[model samples]
Structures are given as structure tokens and as C-alpha cells.
Target: MADHCNGSSHSSESFANIPPIKFTKLFINGNFVDSVSGKTFEAIDPRTGEAITLVSKGDKEDVDLAVKAARFAFDNGPWPRLSGSERGRILMKLADLIEENIEEIASLDAINGGKLFSLCKLIDIPAASMALRYYAGAADKIHGTVLKLSKGLQGYTLREPIGVVGAIIPWNFPTIMFFMKVAPALAAGCTIVVKPAEQTPLSALYYAHLAKLAGVPDGVLNVVNGYGETAGAAISSHMDIDKVSFTGSTEVGRKIMVAAATSNLKPVSLELGGKSPLLIFDDADVDEAANIAFNGMFFNKGEICVASSRVYVQEGIYDKIVDKLVEKAKALVVGDPFDPQVNQGPQTDKKQFEKILSYIEHGKREGATLLTGGKHIGQKGYYIQPTIFADVKNYGRGD
Candidate 1:
């Protein structure tokens, strides 16, 4: 393995201004290496609407390489061979490294994923650190009980590692999702091959750098940034991968399930899309309900899969609640993500921005009343106004 210490360097000043990065590579086996096919993709900054970096356009070849690395680590490397307590120590070290570089990681996430800086620092970063710690604390605690048999034969169970795991995360919450999937898998002694969303790949790549810094062994954890059709399919279908965990759209989840069955019959855990509804009862406080409803839909510009995009307000206070929600949506600040006062940032990419706009148009054409905004904010960036549709039949299907 290459010297992991020479991977990437970040200084205090690098965090001050968003540095120009050429992210045209994949991270595997503790090194940032170019794609086998030598292809690249543009990573745009949603806040500025400019291409900030060029990331590796990974395909089947790249995914195969990463999965092989993870398989090697799981089968023969020191990682799977380490004692549970020793693995826990390394995980704790990773959590500490994340805490130490929270600023840089959060900044990269904001620039790449269009997340608010305040949200990244206050919510995502700290939450990621806490998750790592939680899994670290649980690493050595994973125990199986001994079973007593009726006959003379003695029996027991061993909670062994699940071998190699493939984790595919969405773009909305990159940093937090990375740790959410990675920490638990590591704690369970599973080597991982991660494919972050193509739009928000930088934060995951940067986290891989931190993993090396924290002394994670080569081939233990690998990240390959690419489109879902190629790299994602490779990871999902690889014969050597024992399990697959995916968090993304329901459409993509279906594809992953098919791939898993056809290729290796691997175990799959899918956290798929949902149009969650927030039902407000007549007895609920009007003001609190309005506040929660507004936040649930608009918090991540409604990009999150579990975002409460469908809200059911009881008929008793429907009009009053609509009025309050309209007022709140209008009050939201939409602009640069770096600005602390801005309440909402742009969507993570152009495709999502256009999708949100199309949904607004569908709502309008379907005769749902546009109570507030339903347009773009500025000439640049992928910003969309916080939109509200009232008079939507409580029973009507949300477009």
C-alpha cells in the first residue's frame, strides 16, 4: 500500500476560502488513485452554480477495484483479524480525527452538497462524530450467548463479521450518512466499499483522507465516486460482496434489489424513498404544528427522501394553519449558503432544481393553490423558492 500519510493535506487557511480542487480520482486501499478508465466528471457548487472540481467518473472497472480491496481486507488483512477492543480503539481515533477537522469537512460538504454551513457544523458534523463514537462504544460489546443443549453436545453462537459491505449514500446529507453507514459496519468488523452520490462526492473523498489519517488500514474502507448505473451497479452485483446497504430513491432501490439477486444473491438492506405525511390533529397547537410542518418540507429544500412533503392538516384549523404556513415560507431567506443568516440554500444540483420546479408546475396545473413562492431565486446557482400548495385535497396524491 502507498504511504497513507501523503494522501491530502489541509491547513487552517485552506478552510478560510473554498480551495480549487481537481477531484479526478478514486480512493482505494488508502490512496487517491485515478480511475482505471481515466474518465472524469464535473462537481458543481450549487450555491454559486459553477464547476468547483472534476471528480473521477468511475465505472465498473473502478468499482471492481474498490470491492477487491475491501474483500482482501475482509479476508486477509489485519482489520478483520484485530480484536474487538483494538478495532474499537481505531474507530474512536477516527471519531476524534473527524472532530478535529470538522470545519474543513463541513465546508467541503457545504460547497459540494449545497448544505448550510451552520447546519453542517451544528448538526451534521457533530452528529457524525457522535455516531462514530456510539458505534465505537458498541464494537466490543457485540456478543453472542452460549446455548445449552438437552444432550451431551455443547453449543454456542459467534456473532462474526459480515464480511464485505457496500454502502451507497445519497447527496442530501453526505458527511453524516458516510459515518452512519461506515461506523456501524466497521464496528461489526465489516470492510466497506462506499459509493457516494455523484453530486456530493467531495465530502466522502475527504472523509476517506481522514480515515487514513486516523490509522485505518489499507483496503479496509474504500470510496469510489461515480454514476449509479456503472459504479453503483458494480458494487451491488459483485459476487464477493456479502451484503449491500443502500439509501436512495425507490426507483434506484428496485434496481439494486434486482442486481443483488441476479449477481450474488447477497443480503440487502434498503432505506428507500418515502413521501412521508405529517398528520396534524385538531387538538394540536396551531402555531407549533405550522412551525414543524414548514420545517419538515423546507429544511433541506425538500430534497431529503423522508421530507414531510405531504402534510395533512385537520379541517377545523386548515385555513388558519395555511395562512401561518404561507407567512412562514415567505419569511425564509434564500441565497448564498456561506451566509449564516440565510435560512435556505440552493438544491444540490441542477437536475434536482429542475425536478423541484417541475413539481411546482405540476401542482399549479393540477389546480392546487400556490400559497407562496414557486420560482427561482437568482440568475446563478440552483436555488428554488420555498413553495407551498394549499387547497390540495387532503386525500389527493402529491405529484
Candidate 2:
């Protein structure tokens, strides 16, 4: 099927302008190309729960190609060989291009990942651009240090780019995470192969296109999209890959660690799960603490790793705080992401929706009080109400 857009003309003045998604293939060596298997998966619109576009499905063969391309670029391409100042210039250009196409990028992210347009436009895009600029500014500043030698000879230590980074980013914050992993690697003159979560691949592929437009060289950045078991495993286990940076579940992080060790003992950085806690004292400002606690857990529909899932309060203020939180959650609109008034949008996909629902069910079965919203909102889309379980023990477990 042909790519569809909202039919608005691409112009600077149009706040709702979004260019049609032109390419859904694997981006390798700075080019959008098809997978070796010739298979594609549907990219869905979470709002409508419908198929939007067909994206190339990459597996081991595609990962191999992407890794080899990245290795070649890191070892011999002009990107690594160029002066740090020159590299910074390219990154700066890319940042400018991202700013120019912020509307399009924001749209793609919302449609592909179920992120709110208002939030992506006002939050994610700006943060991603700033991240690129931050790394660009730091690019030329990395310097080697002269060290004291034990003997008559002089010695110096150099900080070099760890080659061929295998970056696996989650679906919750695709665009921001992409920049977080890619920008620093680019600044340090490292090449990379990115495996964006299958649920949210469009933004990363679109970013790759912008990178090419901004004069990032061929093979410097490659993006492959597929299931975690196949494409993710391939990238993690590739002998040519020197490092792996993963942002996902703790279970999957452990798997990636095992894969990294079994493959070539490559270095791995895992930013895994956190059941973060929030403590509220009797002396603290109730309004301020309630607001902070509300935002912490419900900001991303409670999908964030550091979301304050567990809240501990002094017995005196617990009832008051819970009442205020319930009122706040009730006021929040749960509807279309394009609507600025809506504070909570649909969950990213079915799996996450079910997972959250399961937790709510477990809370109920365990006799924890259901304070507010423990059910689905509407028939269509993956929408879930803002759920809260009070009168719960901190160390409670769920099936």
C-alpha cells in the first residue's frame, strides 16, 4: 500500500504538517534498502489500531550486513578519519536539519509509537535536538592527556572511540533514545548499528534519512528493525561488534549480557528496569508532593523506567494525598493524542496494555484497595485508565 499522510502541504507555517512516510526499509550504509529475506511487517497506528505502513523485517543476514558496514566505516571510512572539528560540523548540520523537520519527525513518532503530538513536539523533539547539539559541542573538546612515565620515555593516554556500537532502544521513547545513543557515539568517532524496537521503527529510519541529508557519511549509521529474538540477538552476538548499549526490560538486558559474553566478550551497557520509590513526609508541602508524585507515575502512562510506582507516605498525610491524587487523575483527559487537553494517551501497544492490566488484576486479587480507574476506557485503541492501588504494602508481589 502507498504511504498516507494527513494531506497538509509541507510548509514552515503549518504546525500540523507531516510529510508522507516514504521509506520503510532497513537503512544501511546511509541508504534505505530492503532486507535479504524480502519480508516486511506492518507498522500500526496505535490511535486507530490499524496498519499504517509495511516495514522491512531484518534478521541475522541484515544485521550482519549492517554490522560489517559499521565496522568498515569505523575502521576506514572518512567519518572516523576526519578531524574532530569536521565531525562536529556534520553533527551540527544534522541537528539543524532535525530542527527544520521537527514537525514531520514529531508526527512520525506519534503515529508510529503512540506518543502524544503535543508532548513529542514540545518535549521529545526539542530534547533530541539539544542532545545532538550538546554532543556536537563536546566533539572537538575530547583530548588526550600526557601521563608521567616510570622510565625516561614520555607516555600519553588517548580516549578513542569504541568501534561498532550495537544500540538497542526501547519503544517508549524512540527518538530521544536514538539521539542519546547515536549522538555520543558519533561525537567520539564511533560507527553504529541501531536496532529500534519493532513497534517504533519509523522515527529512527526517518532520522537516518535526515543524517544522510546533513552530510553524515555512508555506513556511519545503520538502522535495522525486527523482533528482539532474531535481529537483536544477531547484533548482540556479532563478533565484529565491539560494544552493545541496550535500553529495555531487565529480562532482556540479562539476555543481551549473556549474548555479549558468549559472542566475543564485548563490552555492554544496560540501562534496565527500576521500580522507583517516592517518600512523602508529614512536614512536606502536600500540594507540591502530590503534584510531583502524580507526574512521576503518570507522565508516560507509567511506562517509564524510573516512574515512581511505589509511594510511601507518613500515616498522617496518606489519606489526604491519596484523595488529591484521585482528584487529579480524574481531571486528566484520556483521548486522542493530538488534543492538547489530553494528559494521558493510549498505551503503546497491546502487550503493554495487557501487562498493566494484569498488574491491576493482581493488585485486586491480593486485596489491595483499587483507589481509582482499574479498567479500560474505550473499545478502540490500546487505552487504559489512570490506575492506582492504595492500601498496598511496599513489598507486595503480583502474579
Candidate 3:
């Protein structure tokens, strides 16, 4: 299907004038190219349920090409061979570039990832820049300790780059996750191939472009966009990749581990799903606890992996806490992310939107009292009411 934008343009003059997303191709060796299979996927805007842009749909072939580039860069390119100070200089340049284009980058994330534009600008983009800067400083300070020998021989550990790294990121916090993975890896002189979530690939591609502009050598950084089943699996199993880092669901993390183990026993790292719980004690201040609980659940429309989904309250103050939380949820504004006044944005994509709604349905079916919201807010876009469930009990056995 052809990907195109629909609905009225939400680009307001008051905010940053974000240019339309133009670089939708896979980024490899500092160049943007279409997938070898000529496949493309529509990146739908969660705000209006319309196509934002078309991104190259990468597969195993694409992953192979990317991994090849990263491997070449690590083994023979100047990036890994450069002295720590030189690498730090380049990383610092990249950080400067990110700060220069922070607004535009944040805008891309807001529209593409369905995050609030203001929040992305105020928190997410700046946080990314901060992360890059922090790692840039570390590039020169990472040192190996000298060993003392009892005999005549003297030896020292050498801190070296771990060849090629494959990074797979999740969609809930695209901009933040991109920097979290890319910054430290770059600072450590490692070449990497990144697979941004298909739901939000714009910012990652744009960042790659900026990296190239900031003097990062060709093949040092690459990005492939596609579903997890194909490109993600390829990265996890690639023979040349020294390590695979994944941030997503536990189920997918297990698959990555299996692929890594079965393929070549390459090391794998995972930051998986969270089932965070918020507990309120009898002596706690109900108002403060309610505020924290509200932010924990409703922030980012509860798409965050660490969203406090389960809430427990002491019986003495349970009613008061629930009442306060319900009141706060009712007051949150949900609408276009571009609107500065809108505090809650739509869910990131259709699948997540539907998944959240289904959970709400199951909550009701399971006899939990729906205290506030349990439905979509508008006809267009993927906005759900801030929902709260009370009187929930664990029905299954615990391990």
C-alpha cells in the first residue's frame, strides 16, 4: 500500500516548524537506501489514524548488509582504531548536533511516536542530548587497570571495543532508547547496527543523518527499520555481531537469547518488560501518594514499560487514595500531541491502542471495578481514557 499523510496539517506556527519526514529509507554506511526487497511500511500517526510516512521495511537481507557494514567499520575502519580523545571529539560533535536540532527531532518523535510535543521537547530530546554528552566525556576516561605481578613479568588489561553490536529498541520511548544504546556504544569505540521499532523510525533515521554530519565515519552507525520477527531476529543471530542488546518484552528477549545461544553463543543483553507496582501504606500522605500514582499510571498514556499498572493500598486509606486518583485521571487532557496544552497523547500505534483497550475489557470481565475510564476518547486517533481498576486480586498461582 502507498503511504501518505491525511487529515489537516497540525504544524502550528507557534511551535517549532518541523519539516515533513523526508528520509524514510534504511540508513547504512552513512547512506539512505531502500530495502533490497523493495518493501515499505506505512508509519501511521496515532493522533489521526493516518499515515505519517513510508519507511523501508528491512528483513534478514537488509540486516546482513548492515551487520557487514558495522563489522567492516569495527575491524578495519578508523572509528575503532582512533585514539580515545579523537573518538571523544567526534562524540562531542554529535552531541552538539543533537542539541542544535533538538526541537525538530522532538517534533518527529511527537508525531511519529504519539508522545506529547511539549514533553518531548522539554524532557525527551534534552535527555538524549544529555546522555550523548555524558558518554562523550566518558570516552576518554574509560581506563584499564594495571596489574601487579609477583614474578618478573608485568601485564596490564587493555580496554578494547567489542567489535560489532546489534541493538534492538522498543517504541514507547524511541528517542530516549536510541541515545541510551547508541551513545555509550559509540563512546566505547564500537560499531553498531540499530533496529528502531517499526512504529517509530523517523527520529532514529534523522539521528543517523546527524551522526554522519557530525563526522562519524561511514559504517560506524547504521539503522534498519522493520518488524521484530525478521530484522530483529537476524541481528540476534548474526555470526559477526559480538553482542546483541535488546529492550522490549520478556517474551521477545527470550527469543533473542535463544537465537544468540543457538547461532554462535554470542553474548546478549536485555532490558525487558516491567510489572511495576505502587504500594500505599496506612501512614502515607494520601494526597502525595495519589499524585505520584496518577503520574506513574497516566504519564505517556501508560505506554511506558515501567508503568505502575498494579496499585496496592492499605485498607485504612484505600478508598481515599482511589478517589483521589480517579479525580486526577479525570482531569488529564487527551488530544493532539502537537497541542502544547494537551497533557496526554494518543497511544503510540494501533496495536498498542487495541491492546490497552483489550486489557481494560478483561479488567471489567474479571470483576474489577472500573473506577474511572475504560473506553476510547475520540473517533479518530488511538486515545484511551485513563482507566483505574479497584478490588483486583491475583487469580493464578505464584512461583
Question: How much does each candidate deviate from the true structure in C-alpha RMSD?
Answer: 7.2, 5.4, 4.3
Name model 1 segments beyond 4 Å from true.
1-16, 20-24, 394-399
Better of 1 and 2 by lDDT: 2
How close is every model to the real structure, measured as TM-score?
0.93, 0.94, 0.94
The pairs that clash in candidate 3 are: none
Which 10 consecutive residues of model 3 have the lowest summed lDDT? 1-10
For candidate 3, what is the lDDT?
A: 0.87
Model 2 residue runs over 4 Å out of place are: 1-18, 396-399
Q: Write the per-residue lDDT of candidate 1 for residues 1-399, one digit (tens) a residue.
A: 111111121111112466555344799998999999888988988876788878888888888888889998888898878888888898899889888887778788888888888789899999999999999899889988888887887788889999999999999989888988999999888999999999999989878888888888999999999999888999999999999999999999999999999988999999988889999989999999998998898887677877898988888998888999888887777766666666777799999999889989988887999878888765667777778898785455573
- TM-score of structure candidate 2: 0.94
Q: Model 2 Cα displacement at 54 (Å)? A: 1.1
Model 1 residue 25 lDDT?
75
